[model samples]
Target: MVAYDGTDFSGFQVQPDQVTIQGEIEAALHRLTGETIQISGSGRTDAGVHARGQVFHFDTKSGIPLDKWRFVLNNQLPDSIVIRSVEEVSSEFHARFDVKVKEYRYCIDNGAVPDVFRHRYADHIRSPLDVEAMRQAARHLVGRHDFTSFCSAKTVVEDKVRTVYDVRVESEGQVIWVICRGNGFLYNMVRIIVGTLVEVGQGKRHPDELRTILLGRNRELAGKTAPAKGLTMWEVSYEE
Candidate 1:
């Protein structure tokens, strides 16, 4: 599956009575295939979290030819979601387990006032942010460590150690984009990281303080969780 704005939907997962993206997509798949199939996604994005290149997989006994899979699925799916491509692979291929890395991008609009058009897509900050300071702080996060401080308290994962491959911050006009690539992320991890970086940009926290936060491994010592609307899953990769 490709990415979506996810603003109009409840969330990525199917719920009892809510209009979720996954529920709609799976319903469409059932309409086309006449099979009650279960889809597995790389991650379960929150209600407002968006994605540009999300991936999912499902099994079918319909025996539809691989070349025609996209055509069939697209016809039944809504306009909000698009099936970019389809291919046949071994049944053992798991979308989440085979994923080698995931990348996310957070957008911040640094202007005196917010734009109505971008309200649903980017975060608007009234105060001026020090871009250089944020960039320096971002560098400190690009390494392997136990990121307990950056994650939300609701995360149930047993292991907190994760490797961050890269972090880049750039500004264009009033928009600042923070891009991060990692092996895996804990719940609300990227949003908290961005929140901390924003504090660093505002001179409320020092760049080196990230090390202390990580060492402390205490969620209370971290910055507040950034809004989910500004975060987008940029891409996902799997190893051969």
Candidate 2:
């Protein structure tokens, strides 16, 4: 498992002339084992997004013990990233393909005063949001559906069908958290969902309008994509 504050790096995937989570880990692996390695992550988070339970898998023939691998690898990586745990899994396990569920949490600072300390972690919204209305809007997004309207129009994937198992909104003091769990998600899907719900909370749209938007199947019908900093890949689950 791994956790990272991704504000400074690009996305998780490696790109030329860009710092990324995968690139840093691969570099550390090369320096520690003297062999070039590639690691596959459960998801490729967007820039400025954070992850608390990101998981990856890599093939290695190094002699280092599994228990020692965590400490040794952390010593070589930057403080922004941390190796939370190291374990040995079966050879048949594949990190990306074998994922069963993913959970994402988006934080909104709805207080009148923005939190400077959490500026890097949460998005600030000064306007009062109707949390119940947001919850109502979120309920419409639950279950399996074609989410073309909620994903980025630039996404090239032809199939937009995905199963959202749950979506709930709650408030804790000044922070409002939107939690979503699904079997899979399209590019910017969760962000767009939060945006649409925010519009509903602001009384700009009715809760029932989400169903119409989903049926419209047009990206333009959806609200703006929420900022990436407020989003976090909270957890990933796999079969036993």
Candidate 3:
């Protein structure tokens, strides 16, 4: 397992010459084992997104003890990335394909006062938001349906259908948390959903309009995509 701040990395994928979570982890692994191996992650988190329980898997031939792997690899990795644990799994195990569910959380700072501590983790909006309205709007998104409207225009996915099992909004003090659990999600899907809900919270649209917008099946019908900094890969479940 791995947890990363993801602020400085380009994204989770290993791109050509760009700093990324995968790139850094692979580099660390190569340095530790002297063998270059490719690692596959559970999800491809966008740049500036954080993850608390991201999982990855790779086939390795090294005989190094599993307990020593974390120690040696983490010493080579930067402070932003942390290897939470290392385990030897069967060859059939695949991190991405074996995932049964994914839960994502997006945090919002709703108060007028700026929180310096949370600037990197939560999206700050000075304007007050109606939490109840946002909650009501989220009800329309739960269940299996086409999510083309919530996906990014940059994405080329032909099959836009996805299952959203639950979407709940809650508030504590000045921070509002939007938690979503789904079987799978398209690129930028959760961020877009949160943006659409924010529009309802701002009184720009009625909560009931979300149903019509969803049926529209057009990206233009959805609100703007929320910034990546506020989103986090909260958890992932796999069938044992």
User: What is the lDDT of every predicted structure here?
Assistant: 0.88, 0.94, 0.93
lDDT of 2 by residue, 103-180 (tens): 999999998999888799898999999999998888889999999999999999999999999999999999999999
Q: Candidate 1, overall lDDT?
A: 0.88
lDDT for 109 (candidate 1):
90
lDDT for 167 (candidate 1): 85
lDDT minimum window of 10 residues, candidate 2: 231-240
Flag the better candidate by TM-score, 2 or 3: 2
What lDDT does candidate 3 reach at residue 9?
91
TM-scores of the models, in the given order? 0.95, 0.98, 0.97
Q: Model 1 over residues 54-120: C-alpha lDDT tens digits? A: 8898888887888998888888877777778786768999888889999999999998988778798
Give the clashing pairs for model 3: none
Off by more than 4 A, model 3: none
C-alpha RMSD in Å of predicted model 3 compared with the true structure = 1.1
Question: Which residue pairs of candidate 1 clash?
Answer: none
Error of 2 at 76 (Å): 1.0
Model 2 clash pairs are none
**Model 3, span 162-221: residue lDDT tens:** 899999999999999999999889999999999999999999999998999889999999
